[model samples]
Every structure is written in C-alpha cells, then in structure tokens.
Target: MRRAFVQAILALFLVEAHPAFAEGPLHVDITQGVASPLLLAIPDISSGAIPEVANGEDAGVALAKVVRADLGSTGFYRFVSVDGHYAAADEVAFAPFARAGAQALVVGRVRLVGNNVLAYDCALYDVFGAHLETSQRILVAAPQWRRAAHKCADMVFAFTTGDPGHFDTRLLVVGQDGERPGLHTRLLSMDYDGANQTVLSQGQELVAMPRYAPGSRKIVFLSFVMLVPQLVLADLDSGQITALKIPPGVPSAPRFSPDGRSIIFSLARDGVADILVIDLQTGGVRQLTNTAGSNTSPGYSPDGAFVVFESDRSGDPQLYVMASDGSGQKRISFGAGAHASPMWSPRGDLIAFTLVENRRLRIGVMKPDGSKERILSDGERDEDPSWAPSGRALMFQRTAAGKALPGVWMTDLSGKLESRINIDPSASEPAWSGRRP
Candidate 1:
C-alpha cells in the first residue's frame, strides 16, 4: 500500500482564470492535450549482477516497471503490461497499441558499471505511427538506479505535456507518535518517493505546516517553540532559526508566496482569525481577508495573483478566492461538506484540500475553480494535504485506525499511497515546500 501511495503521489494534475497566474507568459502551456492515456512498453535491460546478484531484476524489465509505476500513478497514462506486449523496444509494434488504445510508448535501457556508476538510456515514441519523439542518456551511481528510472519518466512526461516534471522533488511535514502523555510533534522530511528520511525538529515545542522557500536551503513553518504559535524559519543545513509574529495570536499555516517574497497565514486573536501576509524583506504585515468568519489556510495561486483560502462566513467553512491585494471575493467550494486547507499546486492545474464526506475526512483534489472534485485518501481520518513542488504527490496526516495517533501519509491524485510510518508522538497538519527553483 505504501509503495503504491508513493508511486501515485509521484505523479498527478489541468484547468482556468487563476488571478495568481500572470498573463505575461506561461512556463508550460498544456491548454490542449490528448485525453487518451499514453501507452508505454519497457522491456528487460539485463545487467551482470545486482548488489547481491549478477543482474538486478533484468535491467529493461526493472526499468519498465519503474516507468510504468511513474506514468500510471499520474492517472494520465495507461501503461501496457509486459504480459500482453512484446518484450523488446526494437520489436515494439505501435500498430497494436495505437489500435489497442495506447497513445505513446516509453522505452528505456540500463547497463551496469562496476561498483560506482550505472548508465541509462531512455526514449519516448509516438506509438500512433511509431515515431521517436525524443531520447536522452544519463549516468548515475549504482544506488541511484531507481532515481534514474524516475528521471526517465520525468523526461517522458515533460516531453508529452510540455510541462516540467516533478518526479525528482521532495516533501517535508510534521510526524507524531500515536500514544503519548503530552503533545509530541516534530518536523520530518523525505524525498518525493519516500527516500532519505530525516527529522528536522525533534519533539521540541509543536511544529505545524513546514514549507520550503523557492530554491533555498531554509524551511519556514508555524512552530510553537515558545508556546506562542509564531511563524518560524529553520535553515536545514545550519539549524539557524528566524521567527516572525506580532505577539499573542497563533500565526498558523505559513506558506511562501509564489515569488517566495512573502508568506500568507491566519492570525487568530480574540478568538477571531483573519488572513494576513508578511513581507520577508521588511517584516511588514498586511491583512488579506476581511470577512466575518475566521479565514485560514491561505494559499497563493501558482502565478501569485490570487489567494485561495477557507472561511466560515457562510456558516460552514468553504473555499473562497480573492485577489492577492484582497479584492474580488468569490466562493468556489459548493460541495456538501465544510472544506479547509486549500493548497495551490505549483503546476497551476489543481488545488488539493481535505474534504469531509459522510462525516469521514479524506484528502481530495479539484480544479482551481472548484470543479471535478476527486478524493485521493478516504479513510478513518485524513486532513491537511500539502502538495510537493511538482503538484504530483500530496503529503497529509492520518490517524491510525481506532487510535488518535497521527502519522504522515502521501498519495497521488489517483489514490496511490506510499508507506505509512507511526511517529513516536501524536502528530497532525502538514504543509509541503515548493520547488527549489
């Protein structure tokens, strides 16, 4: 289940008038795209041996599985199984798949290199008439073979959609133990595929919602280190800490604006919460939402023009949209549930949030305009979804069955889940960082 989750979150996204998006120029425009899922075939790339065996699961075969996993996880591609297709890239007959409902073919090869390096070659073919789209060669260490496979998938995705791939990014969050006398929350970071797990903050005061600055070595999170619930920034490498707040109110849900110049969050005081933005350069504070109900979870659109947030003004908390300068207020979430935690994906195609359905909490994604709602994680209780820089995977906190303990879980929009780890103390609420660049 965990492996499946990781694969799904590793890929996911399209959509509409996002004020945050600049009208200037698009990084990658996928306005028109093929609805049919891409069809791909990966054969056996046999090596001499594995770390322990001569060959590691047949080079081509293994690489195919990884590519399949990555593409299928996106819910945008339908990879043909090796059981029904020819096993060699050279023998690939595009006629059958293009006729059998496949749009594109992903092919690749891998070779072993002593104990330190592995060489890889990958290609994308327009299976409709068997035309090679593009191809590339990459070199990596033995341990980076899987990563190389992901890169291959990234290349295919970028080539087909004309958008940057997010398979190579990472995610960070707060993890908690299920059983503990007192509150136990810590900061946790891991690769997008659940590799290189590390603890950023031990069970020090509670830490909630950690986000990365654009291409920086620092991470900003809402931490109650002094029990004040202020926005704190921690340098991962140097352990340097910088905090921002006006005293009192818990300045929760800190998120970096698209340009990484400011952070927007909710400042709760006198039992009333409102949206506010902090200027990183001047430490200036400006309020965004001036509604009656408490507004929290303010997220900047990919283009940094609009801010989508949650407000209870209508009696139930629902998704609301407003200009970055706090104008043109409109409600989007009309679903039959109170919606909270609106997160804008870096890709600008979708916004991930937690939806409470049938009295059960689940992680779901929807078009930026609040259409085509799909739940990704529908379980006992799942809330606070944070999207990776790629807008592919979503990291959230889930309580164990019949237990209040919350651990971090990630899933792609298609419902694939990665591994679930039980933290030493109860934990909940997570916000992922944006891409380094």
Candidate 2:
C-alpha cells in the first residue's frame, strides 16, 4: 500500500476553453522583472458531481488553495481578498472580478472517478479582457492531488509569463541536525516549495553538495567517511547508493553532464586538484585541467560544449571556461573578487557563482563570456547558487552575520524579491531539479 502511494499516478490533458470567450493578449512580462504583482481572483474550486476528500477538506477547496499558494510564492501573482472573490463555478462572471481590480481569474472543479482517483479541471481567464486563455484537466491518485494543483499553476504561469513552470520540481539540500559535537548531516529532498520532505541519507555519515541529473531520478553527491571525502551516486527511486570509481584522490563538487552520461568533478591528489570527468558507461576517466593551481567546482554549459570552473592558477580563485574536452582554457572572471562554485544557467544565458570579497560571500551571475556581472543577494553570507530550472532565479544558502547556521533563500534575476525557503533545521547547498516526469 505504501509503495502504491509512493508511486501515485498522474495524467494531464488539455481541455477546450469556453466557446464564447477567446484567448487574449494578457501576459506578465517577467524578462524585465515584474514591477507589481498581477492581481488574481481565485475562489474555492467547486465540487462537481462528486465530493472527494483530499488534504482533509473537499478536494476542490484544498486544491484551489494549493494552486493559489504556488502562484503567490513566485512573487508574480497576488490573490484578491476573499471578500473580493466570487464563486469560481462553471459560469464565471468576469465583471465582478474586473470591478474588484483583478487582472486575472482562476476557476476549477474537482470530481472523483473510480476508487481513490480524482479529476481536477482548471481554467485561467483574463478578467479585464473577459476571455479564457487556457484550461487543463489533471487526473491523479487521491494522495497525489497536490500534483494536479501544481500542474494547474504551471499552466497558468506558462500562459502568463511565456516560460516553463518550475512548481512541479524538487530540491535536494544538505540538512544539519543537532549541534557541532554530534551533528548529523543528511541529504534531504523536498518539493520546490519545501513540502513533502524526505531524508535521502541515513544520517550516519555527513553528506554534502548533492546534484540531480538533468532529467533522471539519480543524484551524485559527496559523502565523508572518517573525515575523508568520497563521491557517491544515489538512485532516488530505489534508495540504493554506491561509491563511484575514480582515480586515487579526494573528490568534491560532483555534477552530472547535460546528457546524464558522465560526471565532472574535482579530484585532489598530491598537492594539487584538477577538474576531471568520468564516463558512467565505460568507467573511463579524463582530466580536463592540469594548470598550475587548483581547479574545482566544474559545471557544463547547456549545450555540453563548454565547461565552467573555478581555478586559482592566476592567484585568487576565479571563474574560468574551457572546452568540454579541456582545450582553450581561458579566464572568464576579471572582477575584483574571487569566484567559486560556478553553475551554468539552464537557458545558457548566465552562469551563477559565489563571489568572495571583503571576507563575505555573495551570489552573483554573469553572461557566458563573463560579462554583465551582477550581485543578486545582499545577505552577509550567501553562496552555493543553484539555478532554477527556468534560469530566471536562483536558490542559495544564506547566513546572517551572527548566525551559526545557514538557510536556503531564493532570489530572482533582478536581485529583487527574495524569500527564505520555510524549512526547519538549517539547510544548505540546494540543487533544484528539473520538472518531474
């Protein structure tokens, strides 16, 4: 029963909008940053035909709330007050929402089909335009009704912002439990909004720097045994873990290739560390860097044609880019501070990294050629930037000056609208996963 619940089934189908209304030009331009959140009127979804139980309430009401919360968190849409909301029934009266100053409106219905199966239908409308933009129907297991809501929110987001939605994605973070003497560091997994958390590690050993494969259920991370770092691969669905075979060295910052066929990491042996890649299929190892100084934290460009890493070959640690096979090594960061933990954005437009200056670490981004560098966080200590699947925002670890532990915080590309992920116990090193299959 538990296994069946864990493997909850979900299906999505597009539904035709109302014939009377047509699609209109109502969109939120996110490229330039949303100056003001678009006001939306979202009423409780109606229970149509059958009243199903989900999330301790009628599936209609609960799912509507989840959808509203998901859109609100992105700092893109603001929910109209309950007093200003009208019944989101099959027939929507757009005049009321428009009079309430709502630019957009959402309406939905939930019904139960066979045993423990739910069908959620949601529609998005432009209140001012008085037209239906899109609608979708999601069928899911009762326990997985929340996924339906997330999918609905994603549909609305994509229609409004012209970008892929990231609400259905997951995040892997390093969670610390207990204090320094007997601290238990475990690899944790949760939804993008910090829900349905699960411990991926046994908490027996310290886990750090977890990264998800581009579009798979596997992850690679670093684990310490007896204070020695070891590269580990984990199958999230199977709960199986195995140590990766590599050259004799201490491995750190393991990241998957865009194709998920190989992994790139930094291997430290003797007195120096260099970036290396291991082919997961044939178990062949290749070194990408042999510079004078240490090179580490390597990430791949979206096309897998270039690699970005941090190296101190020129003195302070700065970002460098080279061909995927280790040729054409060149410095990309020429700023005043040192850069590390460089991660390429999914859209292939920017590279996010950690900039260390004046004894403080901050999260920043730069173009592929290392142009238009801009800091996105004002926290005292912000580092370990992981780009969102959409490449429009980033998640990083933030620690206040007087704090002992760091928490995960997210910021948009504009450096405005920052929020801390509401998860208990300090967490760090967040890796955002792509959309779930």
Candidate 3:
C-alpha cells in the first residue's frame, strides 16, 4: 500500500498547461513538451566608431551578448549561429533565415549618442512571414548599457510570448558563508540573473527571509542581533534601516501585504506561535491566529482576501489557510509528507511550498484548496520556495547531501527546466522582486 501511494503521488506530480489554440504572437506552451525549441538568430550588433564604456570594451558586442543570453536562458529559444552582420535598419533576408530553420531573428545597432549616453536600436523579424514584428530605440547612459540590452530583450519577449518580461527585476537574498563556528550571514541584492551583487548589510548581524515590497524599493527582513530576532526595514535607495515596533514577541517569516500598507508574519510567545499583522502607517498590531500550535509563514492571496500559512495544529507541520481576518481556518495539504513555507502565487492560482517526505526535501505547488498537489523539483535539500512576479516560475535554495553551501535555483511552473543562479558567497532564501518602475 505504501509503495502504491508513493507511485500515485509521483504520477500526478506535474500537469502541463494546454497550448492555446488562438494566438497572435508566438507563445511557447510551457505546460506542454516542445519537440523542438523555437529557432532564433541574433547577429552581433553593428556599429561604427563606438567608444568603449567603463571596461574599455566594444559596447556593441557586449550589448548583443546580453540580449542573446537573456533570450536563450528562457529555454524556449535555440540560437542559430549567424556569421554575417546586419545593421538595425537593413532589410532582413527572410529566405536565408527561413531556410536555416529560424522562425525569429533579432538585429540591432549600438551608437554613441553623446559624451556619456548611447542609443540602441533593435528590431525583431518573423523570418517565415517576411515582415518586421516590432522595433524600438532605447537611450541610456553608457554605464547602463546592460539595461538597454535588457529592455530590448523585454521587447522581444513581450512580442513573442504576449506577456510582460521579468528580465528587468531584481532579487533579494541572504548570503551565507564560512564554517559553522564562524558562519556569516548578510543581506544581498542583485539582478535577477545574479549580476551586480551588492551586500546590503554587514556580516555583523544574521539576517533571513528578505522580502521586497510590491512596487516599492523597501525590503523587510528578520535580523538577529544579540540573539534576538527583530523585524527591520531597509531602503534600497537611501541605505537606511529602521526597526519596526511590534507586539512583545519574536517575529519570523515576515512578508509585505499586497498593497504594501501592512505586514503579516508569525510571532511566538510563551512557546506558542500565531499569525499577526501590523499596519505600516499607524503601527497598530492585530493578532490573526490564536492557535495553540506554532503557526507561521503567512502569505497573502493576490487580492488580500485569504492567507495561507504553515502549522502543526494537525499534529504535523502541514499547510493551513484562513481568512484575512483569521477566520475559516482549515488544513489544505493532505499528502504523505510535511509541508512548510507556503507562499501564495502573485496570480492567486497556486501556492508554492517546501515538501519533506522520506527525509528528502522538494519544492511543490498546489491549488489554493490544496487539491491538485504536484511536486516540481527533487533535490537532496530544497527549501524556501518563492514565486516569480509573473507567477510562472519559482526560486529556491538547493543543497546537495554532502555539500555545506546552498545555491539558489529557479524552476518554471512546467517543472521542465531548472537552472542554478551564478552568485557568490553561497546564497539562500531568494526573494524575487516585481518589475521595477
């Protein structure tokens, strides 16, 4: 019976999204398996007498590489090597690209605009249809050449997928290094692809669960100072830290509300944990869950109508959902494992969590009512699953059985592709930011 149950669970671990029948732009059916990835061609950017930027390198080539990397990382496109260069405004030869089995082609040109600014003109073409799909001209400071590339890629992604691209977002994570006796933990921020990493906090204090506010530059995290955990708010622009005054309790698993007006977290007192919310403007506290067991990791639904959290009230650490006001509390997870660290998707369609069974940790997602549970990743130790802003992907930490350091990884909703982020100092607990304004 136990073997049958395990087999049943594995059978339903993933459900692919059906391909849309009606479509204008090319949309990759991530829920279904692609027999062949879409073929794309991106030639090296063409330019004339372009001055080098900070690194004294060809800005044109650098921009092209960034664009190519961004598009290729999606797993939907397979680049076809191109030897010839074409200017951004040149007429595309559709016959060669189509004969080469390329469905899409990207061409662009980089030129110096002024003493410190550059202009990037990019164009995308449908090789088979022999027509231009879209084009854009982006102006940026020479130092921000990557941003221009990202914007260009975003244009291509949006035009192709009919969805907003997440290329311009950032990620907030906790960097951990050193041995156990002298471990160091600090707050770190970087691009979504793990570039331009900047330490936001000194290693003097231990920080965890760094969360970014929706549509804001502020991040709220739990910091341990002098062996006491406190909630701190850090401003990315001003580099200021402020301690939030909460009720007399130890706070953990802090997250910003959907509107960013309040914060919901788990507070422990007298060996009992409960969910609590505090108004950011008025600093008023309200207890949401008053249960005997430990209830933590509260995540709000997209509309802020419901919250899902983890608790041991049912004898094991399972998932539970309740009303925003702490009403209608009920268990949602009922599989053969313990579920923890539940986070509601930004689209409010699914809840992502860490599942532990047979002493192996995995990342899983399920419906709000916890009916269609499906494990997305398998690793020796994978925990703290956070959703992408578009709700199509998740970022988590994975540590091998014998490895002491944990690296950050991302997996899409389809569970077809998993890639480790290239960051230093061993990162964990990644919190993906929404699109920046």
Candidate 4:
C-alpha cells in the first residue's frame, strides 16, 4: 500500500508545546454518551513566503480549509466562522472567538521551506482558557500538501479527545459503473474524506470486498477473472497482482488477519460453504469451519486470537465466534431474522454486522459476548460496516428506500452522528485503511 497513491512525503518541521497546561480543559469526553459537537474556530492561516504551487491556490487558505474540513467531518467538532479575524501563527486573540461561541481555536501559517516543500505551522488554543495547548509545523511536498493539514487536524483531535485521529487514513471501495448483468466494478482508492480518488482496477473484471491488510498497503479482494471468482492479492507499491492458490471451490469474503501474515476467507463447493485461512508466507491453507451450511464473512479479532463470522448452521444466518485455529466455535447472534457480514471492530469491543429482518437491511453492532446489540442505522439498506482506524466510527453503504444506488455513509458509535459521504457515481464495500505513513 506504500504506493497506493503518490506517496506523500511527510516530515516534521517543528513541534513545540505550551507548558501552561499539559492537558487542556477543552476536551470532548467520547467515553460518555453522545454530546454536542465542540465549537471550534479555525480562521484563515496567515500566508508566508509564496511557494511553488501545484493546485494554484493560496497555500495558507487551502491548508486551513482542509484542516477545518477534516475535524468537522468527524462530527466531533463544529467549526465556527471567524470571518473578520485571521488567526496568524504569531498572534491570536481568543476573546472574539470566545464571544463567537467557540470553545477552541486553531491558528496557523503556511510557507515554503524548501524546493517545492511547504510547511504548515499550526497551533491549537483553548479559547476560553486563553492559552495555547499545542503547536506543530509539518512539512510536505507541494503535491501532497493536504497531508500536512490532515496531520495538523490529527494532532488537535488527539490532544483534545485523548484518542488517535483517523484523518490521515485512506479508504478502498468498489466503484460500480453500470447496471447489473452488464455492470462493471473497479477497485478505487481515496482519502478518508473521499478526495484523491484513483482507480486501482481496469474495470474489465468485477471487483468486490477490497480489504486492506492490517498495517500495509497490500490488499486481498474477491475479483472475477473470466467470470471465475477467486481471491487475488494486489501490492500497491509494485502493482503486482497474485491469485491465491485455493483447493477447488469458489472463494468469497477475503479478509486479512490482524497480523497481516494470513487471509481468512470462505469457500463454497457443491452445496456447502465453510471458512478457511491461508498463510501468505508459506501458501498453507487451513479450514476453520466444516459445517453443513454456509459460513462466510470471517474477520479476525484485533489480537488475532479469535475470529467472528457469519454462519447459517442454525437455519438462519447468524454471527459466530471461534478460536483462531477453529476451536470453541459458538453462535453469538440469536436475534430475529438473519445476520451477515460480521466485522470485528479494531478495538475488539464490538462486532458490526448486517441485520436483515422483514426484508429490511440495517447496520448494527454488538459486543463480542453477544450483548448490548443495537442498530446504528435506519436506512432502507445499510451494509458493509468498516471501522475507522480509531474504532470510534464506521463507514457503510446506505441505499435509501426507492433509491436505486447506494451511497457511503458514516456514523459514530452512538449512531447519532451519522452523515453521508458525498461521492459522485455509486460506490460500495468501503474498507478503511490504517493511518498513512
């Protein structure tokens, strides 16, 4: 995945902290129930030495806009416009922002540091407290300037929320080009905010379920080559695609282990389907499920010690958990209707799944022990729940009632902070990537 996109060259120019308060008073307690978004102010960053431009825009303005957009998109911060005031890096007056109902403020400046290199000097301030909380200067190549803004937003989010930010991550999704029967699907890569979209496949073959390895740009997805569905591995860095050697049977639902050294998927031959795992290093295959019915969509626990999957051995498709080596298999879902596409959250606290009841499909999450299950989406059809790197949010495909195409939507753990991601054309099967290097 190192070459998933034009690799952004990121370097730290400077990092300085204000000793006034090690931990700022302005914090969003995410552990508690859903609270209103924290009011934040992000005025235009002051411009410094003009840099060689690629997008032909003011570097300072673009940087601040990106930062504001990143933080606001998380549904954690509500950006308040401070139109008349530009929060320059050197000077910041918090009184006006406080009167504007802003709890926190971000001030920054952008300048050219080297040949084709831009530096984003950002500082996070506590508006009411009248003190600087944290500040950083990040440098990136001109073409990848947006990364600097993402990093700055990440820093602010981390310091304020006490959780790592997912702003610096990527998303892999399947893009559909036409109607069914004659439809074409391609693998696409984009920023987490749905920018920098790049087609990874030729659209010649159908692609689905593109999953990123735990910590790499390498991905394993289900693709059809000449109408034969098989699991293929693609390395973004080298543009090499290798078909996994499977023993007969058609494969589906390919997912990487938490360690990224193996892939767990399901194979169906004849009338039975079971789950299997393949060791990427040795090309060794291991069967994890040998049930009489269909068992698919196997995903690994964050620790790689266990897996959660969907099985219909009990007459209705339900979620099941088992040891990594296929021991202690037990059903976890006994809810009304069917459950499919079980995904273990990165934090290992919950498992997200697709609930099909009375011809309605919705997204829901539950604890690993099959408790505290709750629906998170009310869309007509919501499936494919992919966790953010921080495990605080999920991205899924939502096709409203009477709507023909599905759009990507995101929701926080509480389901109260749901928003649709704006993507032109239709897309599905969103897979969030780990933070970019």
Candidate 5:
C-alpha cells in the first residue's frame, strides 16, 4: 500500500489558503483594449508513482487533458499546441515555448502505488524564469482516483495566478431536451464540462431560473405546476420537495439574501407587477418596489443588508440598489434603453447586467458605484447574465436571428471567451450556485 501519513495537517484537505498562491489585480483596462492572452504549455507525467486513474489510459494524456481543459475555460490562459519535441522530455528547452509565445509551463511525474492506491507529484515553472512552484504528494482512495489528477491541475492554476481556485466546483443548469415546438423541459445538473448530467425534474410543465442556495446542497426555482408559478425548494440528498409560502399569481426570480434567511422575488400581484420579499419562517410578504410599471428580476448583495433590483421607474428599465428594509433607494445604471436583469456579484465589488447598445444587446459588468462599465459580449440579443460561484466567470443566454435559441457562454474578468460550453438550443436564464465561493 502507499504511505499512509499526515504531514502539516494541511494535506488532509484538498485546499489550503496561502498568500503565496493568491491572484492579484490585473491593471489593464478590461472595457476597451483587446490584447493577447498568455500561452500555457501543459506536459504529462514523466513516470514514477502514477495516479490510480492512469492505470488503463495514458498517464500523460489524461493528466495533461485535465489541466488543459481547466486552464482553457478561464478565457485567460491559452494552451499552446506544441506537436514536436515532446518525445525528448529531458532535452526540452525554453526555445519552443518562447517561440510559441508561451509564458508558463506545467510538468509533473505520476508515481504508481500498490494495486488500487496511487500518488501524484507535480511542479509548476514560470517560463520567464520568474518562479518554480511544487505541490505535495496526492494520495487517493480507489473510488476517488480521478480527483487526484484534478488536484494537481488546481494547484497549477492557483500558483500561476493570485485568485481562489474554481476548477473543482460543479454546475447546475436547466437543459431543454426533445423536438422543437412540443419540447420537454427537464432539469439537468452536471460537472463543469457538461458531463454526468443528472435530471432533477421531469414533467409536462416548465421550469425556469434554477438557482443553487447559498450552501449549494439545496436548490430553489420557479415551477409552473397548474398554470400558477410557485417558488419551490428541493433538496439534492433526499429528493424531497417543499413549496414556499407565496401568495397567488406568478412569483418569479427567487433569490436568497446573503444571510440566506429571506428570499426576494417578483410577484404579479392583482394586476400590476411588483417586487416582494418573503420571510422564510413566517411566510410574511413585504413589497419592496411599488412602482406602477412592471418590476422584476431581483438580486441581493453579498452582505445580506442591501439589494439591487430592476425597474422602469426612470421611464426605461434600469438597475437600482436599496437597503434590506426597502429604504434609501438609489440608481446604479445609466446605460441606454432596456437595462434590466442586474445580478449582483457575490464579491460585493462589481455588478453584471445586460444593456442595449446600437440596437443589439450585450452582457457587461460595472462597479456598484456605477462607474467603469464594460461590455463583454455582443450578439443579436444577449441577456440574463449569471455569475459563477467564484464570481470569476459569467454565464448568460445568447440568441441569434430571433429563433428562441439559448446557449451558455462563459467569460472571465478580462473579457475573454474561452470555451463555448454549448447545450441544446433553447436553454435560457442560467444561474450558477454560490457554494464554492
């Protein structure tokens, strides 16, 4: 068997906070300048004690692919496709990476353990001769063997940048399957790669805007059971469902406050549309916005004391922020017409929203103080921007030529679209969970 021991007590957990591996601020102007992304070169294990998942598949291929995929999705790191000179691992020099315009390289060795157990040892090097970083040995149980390779990839990501790691998290989305027109709506949750998709709900009715609770073990969404939209909460472990205490008519966009004690949503009360907040324990509803115009698409701040919502009080749909008690209301958006669907970043520093620019819609993020606005994407219609749990990546719905086509597109803080992560067309309103932050 492999060595069974604990050193520094940090090896027992998958992640440990260290300033030596933090993601610092990027000083470049993200709104205007479109610059080149840093090139990344990821090589496979050189031999030794390989991870357990490397038994059947090529160790180098499996580990290298994982690292490539994780880094590629960030929209920041570009993987360099170097074909030749991989055979001569020992004689590999810095010229190839330099010629390919690569800035960083990750190399590792996989040590094979007895029977079912394995260990992984990896090292990250800065091609510009800036720094050389290493990782502790990765010991894995047989069932969780694949996670060992993912751990090494995560360490490489944290070392190269000064931000918290997000490669090990999961994504829950609403996948629409079946033929056109008469389609079937079922809830699909999967890993970040769209694999291991598990159906959460299946039926004839429609489900929209599935959001993960603060802790991520539970989910809250809007469901139309009998032509009435009700706020429903489901537990992932027990598959049990509970109906929230909401009034009659349609109540959509259910978002949990920062403290997770109350939920703010939009209700079509009587005839006019308004935003309301419900106390989780007492089921008491407090109307937040009483504007005569339609009010919808509500979000909460990270501190649980303030909220940012959308309304047409300014003669056009725009974003607004207010206290938890519905006092001291202030406007945060000054963009062109139809600036709705504002989702507050969990980091409490930025807000991601949608706007109409040049008769087309695009996704953008700005400071909560209404400054430094930058559009990240452009299309015929791109609306409903959702933030990743880490607040580093933003996912939204995209439509071209107006056919009700919706696909998920992710981008980083620097406005780079890494991978398209496409799903079946007609998928819309994606909200990533807030757990892994």
Candidate 6:
C-alpha cells in the first residue's frame, strides 16, 4: 500500500506541474497597477408591504444595507448612496445614473410572501450601456433575510468582476479579551462582516490555529489539554470535539485536506518538529518531513497534490514544498528575510505568507515557485494571513503601536483597500471558511 501510494503521488506531481491538468476559472491578477474603483449606484430595495421580521426592523432597508456594505467593503467599488434617489426598481432612471458617473446600477425590491417568508427581486444594469445585465428573485425565511441580500450582492459582484463572490462565507477566529495577565481566548464563528457571532468553545482550554475543513462544517485546531498540545476536530453544528489519535507530540497548525478526510500539521517530538498527516477515518499516520530543524505551518495546495510549509532546515525559517506524500522536498523561498505561515490561495494562483525583516513583520504573497514576491502591508505587526474564499482578499491580524490588542483587518489581494472588522473583544487567528452551502 505504501509503495502504490508513493507511485500515485509521483504521477500526480507530473500531471499537476503540467499546464493541461490545471482546472478552475482564471483569476484576475490584482497585483498589477492600481485601477480606479468602479462607480456603482445602489438604490434602496422598495419596501412594498415588506413586513418586519422578529427583530422589528424594516426588512427591505436592512437587506439593501447589507448589499451596499458587502460591495463597499471589496474596495473595488465606489458607492453612490440612494438617500433621495429612486426608491423602487421601476423608478430608476438609467440616464441620471449614467450622467452621475455610475457604470453599474443595482436596483431591487422586497415584499412579503406570507407571514414567515420574504421575497427579494434584484436586478443589475449597465448604466453606460443602458442594458440589463442580470436579474433574480430570491426567497427566504423571514429570519434568514440577510442571506437573500448576500446572494444579491454576490450576483452583482460575480457579474461585474467575473469571479465568484465571497460575501456568503463565515470566518473562524480566536476571540481574546481581558488584560494581559488574565487574557482568555475562545473559538468563535461569525459571518464575514462580523455579524451573527457565535462562540464555538469555552475559554477553559487554550486553543490556537483554528482551521476549517474544506466543504465541511468541521474545524481542526490545536487545544491544550493538561498543558500538552493536542489536535482536535470540532463540529460546528453539534459542538462536538474529538481528539485525533496522533503520536504523543505537541501538535500545532492543523489544516484539513482538500477532501476533509485527513489533516496536516506540525508535531514537536523531543526538541524538533516535523510535518505529519493523519487520516481521520482509519487513524492512519504518515510522516511528511523528517528534517532535523523544525518544520511547521503546513498548507495544502488547492488541488491537494502538494503541501507548502515553513521550515528552519536552511538555518533560517523559509517556505518549502513537498509532494502530498512527503516526497521531492525543496525550498522555494530565498528572500532576504525569514518567511512563515505560508497559505496557498484558494484560486491556486499565489501563496500568501508572513515575512519578518529587521524585527518587523509584514504580509506578502508570491508565486508558487517563490518568485515575484511582493509585500502588501506595512504594519507594526501583521501576521496570520487567511485568504478569502474567492482568493480576492485576505484577513490578517494587525497590532498597531501603543495598542497591545490585536484586531482583525482585511485587505484586497492588491492591498489597495484595508478595513478593520468591527467586533468587540479584540480577536486574532482569523480563518475564512469556504462558501457555505
């Protein structure tokens, strides 16, 4: 079984390196020169008898706010508010929007379907070309009305940018509070915009490096049990926790495989750490790296054929890649500073990482082969980059001068726009989940 597995992995390496086997839509290269933000007009969705939900709020106006916020946060659009502008979709005047320099216009309306259901009709238009781009009618339970707005914004984002939208995603983060001596951290989940925050774990146990399982509601993290680090699997829905049967070692940086059947992490045995993988179903273990120096922060390529990790085998911590089964290990980063926390983009085009130079940390991205490295952020401390599901942006932890608290902030892949996620009780270790079904 081991021999055949190695052979199959070798075959995959050959195929994956070639151009023909590559799949997925081509992503826009945002690293190029800064472009002007697209002018977009978002009129409030007409509230035609749209009854309030349990929250006693105007569902139509709330939905429009969500849509506007989602698009505005992307940093690729300049919003034209609809305060005194058109209210209903039919009242829209394309000529006025075009004259106001709006290239695209989004108009929608919300109405009550029944006592417990709501319907939203959204439409996108090309103002300059005077034509309708797309339209859809979405229905949802009154309590779930936020999702309908997200769906509408996603449609507009996809129609304009030619990429999948990330508005309908959730983020897993470690929520920390209290003073330094008594700091407490807990696992928390919330919408990408910091809404609907849910605490997934109590603060009794120390946890770090929370990662979401691909296409699953489970998360893999490192939890301290009896002062020993153990890899734990957490189900989001049921709040169940199961410890993986890894060898007795200090586990950290656990990330799920693309198939969600296995996890790759670093385990420190004795005084050295190495990368390893464990199959969840069979409790089978496979060692990926056996180097003398510490090898940690293993991240899988989107296709699951290769794994990138940070290792100090070269005397300085740098990025390295090996086959999924721990073959053909080679160093890929040779920059001036040490690099760590390497995260492969979901679109499979670039790798984001943290670079430390002269005692300062910055977030950057480079090609898979470690070329064309470009630092995208300038912060006193910026680390732990987690890619948005669409690979268009990144969320990382930022700590400013005189502010010991670390807060979560996001920036476009180009670093042209940056915004802080407004969540009380400063947070860190943000892991953006894949688009939820």
Question: Each model's TM-score?
Answer: 0.76, 0.91, 0.89, 0.92, 0.80, 0.89
Which residue pairs in model 2 clash with each other? none
Q: Quick one: RMSD of model 6?
A: 8.5
In candidate 5, position 282 carries an lDDT of 83
lDDT of 1 by residue, 89-156 (tens): 44656666566655566667666555666666776666665666667665666555666677777777
By TM-score, who's the top model here? 4
Between 5 and 6, whose TM-score is larger? 6
| Model 3 Cα lDDT, one tens digit per residue, 1-437 | 01111110000011112222225434555555344566888877556445545365666777888888887767777898756766545665777777787888887787876766777877777787776677777777666567777777877776776556777678888888885312798777877888766778776878888999995378999988798999988777666778899988889999999999999999999999999999999999999988889999999999999999999988889999999999999999999889999999987889999998899899999999999899999899999998877676789999978888899998877677889999886898999998765
Q: For model 2, where is the 10-residue window of minimal lDDT? A: 1-10
Model 3 gets an lDDT of 0.80
What lDDT score belongs to each candidate, Candidate 1 first? 0.67, 0.82, 0.80, 0.83, 0.67, 0.79
Query: Tens digits of per-residue lDDT for model 2 on 1-437?
Result: 01221343456555566432223555776666686777888788556323335546666778888898778767888888544333335566787778788988888787777777787778888887787788877777776677888888888887777677787788899987675312788787888878777777766777888999985378999998898889988876666778899989889999999999999999998879999999999999999999777999999998999999999999999999999999999999998899989999999989999999999999999998999998889989999999888787789999888887889998878777788887788788899998876
**TM-score of decoy 5:** 0.80
Sorted by lDDT (best first), the order is 4, 2, 3, 6, 1, 5
Candidate 2 stretches with Cα past 4 Å from truth are 1-24, 35-37, 46-55, 81-90
In TM-score terms, candidate 1 sits at 0.76
Q: What's the residue-level lDDT of 351 in candidate 2? A: 97
Clash totals, every prediction: 29, 0, 1, 1, 11, 0
lDDT score for candidate 5 against the true structure: 0.67
Q: Which stretches of candidate 3 lie over 4 Å from their true place?
A: 1-22, 31-36, 48-54, 87-91
After superposition, the stretches of candidate 4 with alpha carbons farther than 4 Å from their true spots are: 1-15, 18-23, 48-54, 87-90
TM-score of 6: 0.89
Best model number under lDDT: 4
